[model samples]
Target: MGNKLNQGWLYTDRINAKVVGQTVLDFYSQRYGHSDRQVWQERIELGQIAVDGKTVNPSYPLQAGQTLTYWRSPWAEPDVPLTLPVLYQDEDLWAIDKPVGLPVLPGGDFVYHTVLEQLKIQFPQESLFPLHRLGTGTSGLLLLGRSALGRRELSRQFRENLCRKIYRTLIGPCSLSEQFDCHQAIGKIPYPQLGYIYAATADGKSAHSYGRILARSPEKPGWK
Candidate 1:
């Protein structure tokens, strides 16, 4: 609302960092000596700010073990007319329902046309932290973290196999009950034959997939 004040403070060696925001009126009033702590009926909502590491309330009074960050936001950045649809949020993560065809980050040939640029334009003051990748053709939930602490917590979840993932695909089929597990050696196919690492094997990355017939269309007779 007003000039965004971005400041950081650390209360203790083991604590995390935090931020404060001001609405349009209070930002200008702070230039003078402690005139009055600008209060937002809401944004002044002080809280401990770390992604995965800790939890704190805005009025925690900044103990000796905490840190703070500030951004004196001047109000002139052009508004981004478009916005990202946020699906879920908490101290540790932002989950978004991504649309198909949008790449997750900046890269060759994309530059200003990417999701990172759009988000930066939308929330001009807060730094965005993106973790993980999704192909441009894929659409689903994307997870993001706000601070180093949060990143650590999410990384632990990834390492401990605590995350749940599921995917679906539509492919034409030929059998009524086409189900079988093909277990075999996936060594390189000799010379020209084409092949790939397949099924549940003792090597390669571990992944599991399951599929069943959902709907059969009258337009496709072989699907039965």
Candidate 2:
């Protein structure tokens, strides 16, 4: 699809005690590094940011329980496939074959070019929300919930480990092993570009994955 001009966006957040004394500029620049300090200052000066329903200077000190709102001007978003193939559908659930490169949610430089936005456009009358997420580069079946009761129950199942999720990936060739398991703890580490990102670490939360060899490619020297 061609690049689309979004109808702007209104983002709001509540100031918490952790950042109660931070300046408006510092809060945004430190927490959200999408824009630089100069860009944030420009937006604040243009009345794009407000606290408690009133525009404030960049140096304005934030207080706990205050509402901060930002009006992001409409801009052209990156082009992406806007098609979603329905694999299964029911009264309370839907399973879609999500295409690769389509973001499951809005983040980074994507806003209107996400699966959630396409869902809104295709099913305007229905209130469906994604129950799980797939990476932008992964193609897989995405499950969505159409009712609050269904969503709550499925969320509970996921939290309690009642659901089994299996993923297939291509990796460099290694010694043959019938089956393998990984117990690497994953946690966020500081990243200069995007604040923090998940990686395996000793003090991170427990994570496990099971892999079974499906096939091997002689030409590519990889296992799937």
Candidate 3:
């Protein structure tokens, strides 16, 4: 229905059966009961939604049937993250602590605020492999695998590096020569997603990064 004070309707089993196929602040927080991510973050800032018509994704995955439209939002409300924090899970694996800006699933603009829909709302019954890839801001340890021999033993321990990785980077204001060696040839610049580190001239490809500068530096945010 026209103008922004708004109202429109449509859903397969015939209209007005109590808002079909869901949405429109999940039928206004289930007719005022809230929670469905509290009306999907209150209609995503009140622009009042639009699915088949476009502008969708407040987790957008509603389709055992389709159709959703909205235009209801009196004011502010956004920080609708109900939960996610499982430092470890069993039956074959599930680790967490991926904070820093979060994103271990759902690409680009970040669908449903990632970490695989918060581990599918905590193991919605299966499938959760995710071996490695932590750089959405880069925080710490994360490895998930749940059966199938724990995803083939953590995918053969991250493809044979035997997994004992330790990282703690944050360096600058260097004075060099503390046993230096970064003989490089890093690659990746195709479909896109950053990766570089040169100096193996005559076209590079085999990267190497082995260092040990345990401590040293003399400025602010310094080093130790």
Best by lDDT: 2
Worst 10-residue lDDT window, candidate 2: 188-197
lDDT of 3 by residue, 1-224 (tens): 01222123222222254455565445445543323565556565554666656666554545534445654433221222424567878899888677665656543234345566657666688788578867656677688887889889888887787886666676777777766667676543222122122235535676556676777647535343
Ranking by lDDT: 2, 3, 1
Q: How would you encode candidate 1's per-residue C-alpha lDDT over 115-172 as one tens digit per residue?
A: 6766677667655566665555567787777667777887778778687555554555
At residue 115, candidate 2 shows an lDDT of 91
- lDDT at residue 202 of model 2 (Cα atoms): 88
Q: Residue 169 CA error for candidate 2 (Å)?
A: 1.9
Candidates in order: C-alpha RMSD to true structure: 18.9, 2.8, 18.6
Better of 2 and 3 by lDDT: 2
Pairwise TM-score winner, candidates 1 and 2: 2
* Descending-TM-score candidate ranking: 2, 1, 3
Tens digits of per-residue lDDT for model 2, 128-179: 8998878677899898998888788888888898987889877765785879
**C-alpha-based local distance difference test score of model 1:** 0.47
Please, what is the whole-model Cα lDDT of each candidate in the order they appear? 0.47, 0.84, 0.57
Q: What would the TM-scores of all predictions be?
A: 0.44, 0.88, 0.24
